[model samples]
Target: MINNRYDFIMLFDVENGNPNGDPDAGNTPRIDAESGYGYITDVCLKRKIRNYVELVKEGEKGYRILIKADRALNSKFDEAYEAENLKKGQKGKNTDDVNKAREYMCKNYFDVRAFGAVMSTGDNPCGIVRGPVQINFSRSISPINIQDVTITRQARTTGDRMETGSTEMGKKSIIPYALYRAEGYVSAALANKVTDLSEGDLELLWTAIINMFEEDHSAARGKMCMRKLIVFKHDNVLGNCPSHILFDKIKVKEVSAPPRCFSDYSITIDADLPSGVELIEKI
Candidate 1:
């Protein structure tokens, strides 16, 4: 079950596909062996979405999902900034004194190296670990249509050739897959105080809301990843209801692929064990 406050998460395990491909080369979400899957990130985000809508049964009526895509950092900062200032000099008070400031002088918070991340592409694109946006009841008070959001992480540019030199080496911005951990919290209004919506009610409410977008099995699987979910809650929060947010960091304890194997404990004593059995346990 989820609460009043929630955070929506989205990750793109892009192996080798670009929904927005380069126009020069071609205009399409390019698909290649390198293209990664969106399952992990999508599922992590959907979990929280499911929780939030479910927790707020009535709130679901006005529920709407909005995605504020990544905003770019301005580039023209290398130039100088000029400002008028009156200075007391040996000659006299001079108002014509204009001082030149470095382009970045105005803003210390701007990440000077961030723009470079946006430029790298190809097999390795910019990795977006951007913080999730928080939405509360008051902000989502108005009734709106519920829309499923599929954030397609695409490469904006091909990475520099290996010969670009060490200085040109940029971190791969495009990640085929990223490790994500899902966590969440609920508000006090729904937790401490009594509300018409119960945990069961919230779950039921979300079941319908989520199903609207999860119609196709393949789609749901593809979008929701492995169909795993994790949840949490917070108390005395600004909002009165429980909030939900999806987590992407779920990890399998162990993973094995390929050829199957049979244990030595086969039905017949002489029956041979299958190949590839690292070790076998017996009851």
Candidate 2:
């Protein structure tokens, strides 16, 4: 079981692509309208992490993804109840059976152990689990610019358009370049007491974060990469210092205006750290 708490800062960048698009705004890159800072949702990052875990740990025991695509969540919940040999609980109430199913999920699913889940939607009714790991939304350091690029297809879809030699025109949203930072936390208390997140699981979480974007390349996400992963591990289960204080110790500044690459910015870390805390750079 995990015995120490951890806080981490992730730095990633996107070039010539949309890191995340807002479907409501015609799939434009998500941004803070007021500040013009680019945004990538926590859910979006989590999905990439989940995909990485699922890919690397395929068919491995205790590494199943709970919220996978094309899989029914209620069916998984039912499987948990059936596997535990417990009867389904009534609506709005958690029983010992429900607790058993919840434990089953925590034991079998990596995401459940790391990120937790609410399994009360179905008749099986597994109780909610407060995961040991949590991540915040990523925000760019500086204001970003979004561009709409137009492209044309050689062949037309419709017969009439084909006969007229018409081409299909499409628009793609992109950010010329941007660097984003996201903060994440790992709770040892929750890990030991709640989800039983193990040391191996913790290590796997780090690996997943470091490689979340490696296999997730696409035309839309253009050239995304994990630039830096700075971790602060406390000596004990309860952290030695506040997360904000540790976060403030690291500084990211744009050395050049209209930055288009990672080297255009400078990142500085304060070597003098608080007691009972150790900083590890996992890039």
Candidate 3:
């Protein structure tokens, strides 16, 4: 098995406003100060949702692969998996579920992808140009390799007189742990290649990593519109991944510009998301 560490990072921004807070709370979600209703039609909302789903799917897979690799490194787990009486698919699902939870926690804690939109309250909301929300996602898997690690075991077998051979023939010998290490190398290199990335090379990279979490199309859409994003160490696929190993250690950036200025803009949407997801108006 290929034993190598995989590190990846993705970053980008998208437009925000509308759907950020409780619109009924005397506060209208405005972009640049233009209250009332945002131009994002229902069609647009659907489109965004679809995009998010695709991104989540892709991100989740990448996360799963990493988790699997980690499990393979555990001698006890690997032994149980390679045991003669074990089933064919022992470690796959268990590892995947655990990784899924982990990814979800990270996304929620870091707010890697913006969900609802936030609007400006002051004056001239529609006057200021709101920039995209930046997102960054990073991951690193080290010591990934297949090695011949030894494990010691005590003898537990007895032989019958009929088994005429060496005295140690039927007896169990103290054998060392010897198994093939299936170290997994999953980063943007493998993630993006399998994913259908949509805008902002940086955003696309982040979306790909988000796919390592839950299957939420909205997250991907958010990345496209400069709203939500994903960041990682580097782009191993095209050598764009980041050089840092502590991606999770970084902080997620918030929108610093005005909201109203972030008017409707065209963005490349990933075609893999749900079908009916279209851009929508905030009503």
Candidate 4:
């Protein structure tokens, strides 16, 4: 089991693509209205990590993904109860049984162990778990410019349009270029006492983060890459210092105006670190 707390920073960039879309805004790239800075939701990143884990470790023991595509959540809750050989009880009355199922979930599902879950909605409800790892939303270093590109396709869904040979028009939202930074935390205390998150699981989490974008390729999200992963590992279960202090040591500055690529920005990491904190650069 892991014996130390961890704080990490992730640097990623997107070129000519929408990193994340705002469903409420005609599927445009998510942006801060006040600052005009682009941002990707934590849930978006978590989904990518989960997808990567599922892709690499499919059908592997203790690596199942609880929240996955095309699968009903309640069925998973039922599976938990069935696997534990326990029957579902009254919604709020089966504390012991719920905890047992929750343990089963944490043991079998990698996401539950890392990201936690609220399994209180279904008939066979497992208790909620506060996972060991948590990630914040990633935000760009500067305001970004969003472009709406019009696209045309010759093929059409309707047979009449096909006969007419008229092109179908579509719109795509894209960011010319943006470098985003995300912060995350891992609690050894929670890993040990709550989720049973082991050293192997921690390593898997890092691997997932570093390679999350590799298999997730499409025309909408073009040329996305993980630029850097800066990890601050503490000596003890409780961290040696505040996470903010450690995060402040890393600085991202744009070397050119209207930066169009990653080379136009300079990333600096301070060498002098706090006592008992070791910095590991996992790119």
Higher-lDDT candidate of 2 and 3: 2
Per-candidate clashes, comma-separated: 37, 0, 76, 0
Q: In candidate 3, which residue ranges exceed 4 Å CA deviation?
A: 17-207, 210-283
For model 4 the TM-score comes to 0.97
* TM-score of each model, paired residue for residue: 0.24, 0.97, 0.19, 0.97
How does model 1 fare in lDDT? 0.26
- lDDT (tens digit, per residue) of candidate 2 on 64-101: 99998768898998888779777665653657788888
Give the alpha carbon lDDT tens digit for every residue of 1-283 in model 1.
2343432221112222221232443332222323321112233344444444434433343232222123422222111121222232212222122112211221221111111112111221122212222222111111111113345433334356434433332221222222222233333243323222335444443343334224333322223221222232223234422232112222222122210111111121212222221111111
Candidate 3 lDDT by residue in tens digits, 1-283: 1111133223222222122222453332212233322222222332333355444544543221211223322332233233323333333434443334323322221122222111111211111111122222111111111122233334435566335543332221111111110111233332232222213333443443344223332421222222323222222243332233233332332232222222222223233322222222111
Number of the top-ranking candidate, with lDDT as the measure: 4
Best-to-worst TM-score order: 4, 2, 1, 3
Q: Please report the TM-score between candidate 2 and the true structure.
A: 0.97
Candidate 4 whole-model C-alpha lDDT, 0 to 1: 0.93
List the candidate 2 regions with Cα displacement exceeding 4 Å: 92-94
CA-lDDT, candidates in order:
0.26, 0.92, 0.27, 0.93
The CA root-mean-square deviation of candidate 1, after full C-alpha superposition on the true structure, stands at 20.6
Model 2 C-alpha lDDT versus the unseen true structure: 0.92
User: On a 0 to 100 scale, what is the lDDT of residue 87 in model 3?
Assistant: 36
Better of 3 and 4 by lDDT: 4
lDDT of 1 at 10: 19
